[model samples]
Target: MLRSCCFRCFGRRNGDGLLWHMDLKPHASGDFSIAVVQANSSLEDQSQVFTSPSATYVGVYDGHGGPEASRFVNRHLFPYLHKFSKEQGGLSPDVIKKAFNATEEDFTRLVKRSMPVKPQIASVGSCCLVGAISDGELYVANLGDSRAVLGRRGFDGEKSLVAERLSTDHNVSCENVRKEVEALHPDDSHIVVYCRGVWRIKGIIQVSRSIGDVYLKKPEFHRDPVFQQYGNFVPMKRPVLTAEPSIVTRKLIPQDLFLIFASDGLWEHLSDEAAVQIVSKYPRAGIAKRLVAAALQEAAKKREVRYKDIKKIERGIRRHFHDDITVVVIYLDHHKSSSKPNHKQGTAGCITPPVDIFSYNSDEAVENSGDKIFPNEESRSRVAY
Candidate 1:
């Protein structure tokens, strides 16, 4: 059975408010920490870690426009990964891409089914970042701006750790991403325009690749009524967004210390180097929460308010100060003896935070929202001991 990391159960509340976290947990390679803070009416960020004796999987889904896409991905993406990996005999770039494509296709089908009742579903989308580790190899895949960063020991016998980016952000805020979008849609003079003080695709969205955003991808869903609720919708001859993910794979070495997987919310206030430094300087336990706290402090500073005051702010109002932030820190135990077992022997399972931070009954919500694993599949995967 999948384990729900509810505050009332294995996890703990960071404070009396919207922050919740898992201080530390053991994975196949080593330990991991997870933390999340809500800033949206409904939490738009969903994340999880699945571990086994042979492999580990990590994902952070940062939703926009609505939480539906992220939540959907949080539920289905891993299972698809497991299914395809099993069929393909092992994990590979092709397997990861196939799983992504399958998830995108399935979500589009879901939107089609829900359109009659919920036309707004077409506009919801999520940034996806995934990291898989197997046999001392790491694979990072991403869409939109969520990031996976490696904190590695310095080269040339230096003592400090270095921050190495593992995923490419696909948001149009970057000049290169803007150029890529423009090159793809040269016919559309306004493919990307400066709006609301930042660059946005078609003046509506920022990310050029994501799991959802059907209205921008399918012409049939581009009518006025389809996007009437969301003004500033632009008509396009072709898809302005894609589900394709940029992927990177690397063989792990002793120099690789840890991995930081987080949504753009944390990256907005903290640089890759700063985040790695935090991880390098702090204790392993609660390190993810520490990162979240640091980012919140920076967010508060930007708004010229006290951190305590921001903590008192409610979710929707709090979003003005910061987006829903999620951070997962995975440590690689290179020092572990090679003869030792990869992971503790136990039933295979997964660990994920409560679906929504602000839910009145998080335990109940988590119980109802436990992940669905593929049928008859068994791999000794778990995040916590």
Candidate 2:
């Protein structure tokens, strides 16, 4: 039987300025949890949680160039999502897409207003990952390289569990992604290049899809003061980047156990199987924090430092070892839900909540302009665990 529960059981916790956590709560599988750790000089990651008797929403946002873009999305995206859901009378792909479009358009307008004063704003961008569970369905959507992995049981056997990825990564390091960029701009032979063993677009950004980075999406931002640092190229052309998202929808079943939603930072030190293994073997409460701790321990191993020692390192300096990492583990409850396989769900969930998402597999040598790829992370797509 698929266990379901009302979203009201959420609990929240904060770690240092660089770390924060949310313990288990009512979720599609059972209980849900989340955690975030800052490794950047300034926290470039943002996250959100919304739960009710009927639905739950999770987001992880990884900002690059600056925190402005992520903060903006954190403050605005959820409201837009709620608005679209209400207008459409329920959550659907159209509503989710509209929510993303609204957020992208809003951020673009903000850039048009600020770029004259802050040229670098045009360069700021964020990878967004969102997961929404309503009724008996689960919806996962992404822009950039963030990832979502599902853990399930009763597959190989009742006691055996596995990890299944649920999102598409837009990082150019993937040959398919590189081919995609080339196909999108067949005229540009140098659209994607291999540098430092990493693949990048236009020899700069690694992500081909994102919420901001107006400098890439608009020719207007390609010239002068704003994008001067982005380097000069031919004049007048179509966009160099896109904000559209890749989406996946599925019916939640009894075998589905939990999900691990995280930023590229975590992927740097962990694998889908490893992550699912950890989750399957541990307790549900604070599972997200446990994942972060596991990743940090792995990061320390690369530097040959003790995990305790690594935890003592401060933010700005710590970034040398790891990127900003954020994780949310949603433990689905198939045991408590009063609903059956065909039963209707309750009407719950509020429109007000913080929404942020970022996940990637960076174990590969990746190349993106401006941002240096530290040898600590990797990125990937969604697959059924």
Highest-TM-score candidate: 1
Model 1 ranges with Cα > 4 A deviation = 1-10, 157-159, 224-233, 342-347, 360-364, 369-385
Instruction: Note the residue pairs that clash in candidate 1.
Output: 51-381, 51-382, 52-380, 52-381
lDDT of 1 by residue, 230-257 (tens): 4445678899999999999999998899
- Candidate 2 C-alpha lDDT tens digits along 9-78: 2234333434566665454335677777777655688777666566778888889987778867766677
Candidate 1, number of clashes: 4
What local distance difference test score does each model get?
0.83, 0.74
Model 2 lDDT on a 0 to 1 scale: 0.74
The TM-score of candidate 1 is 0.91
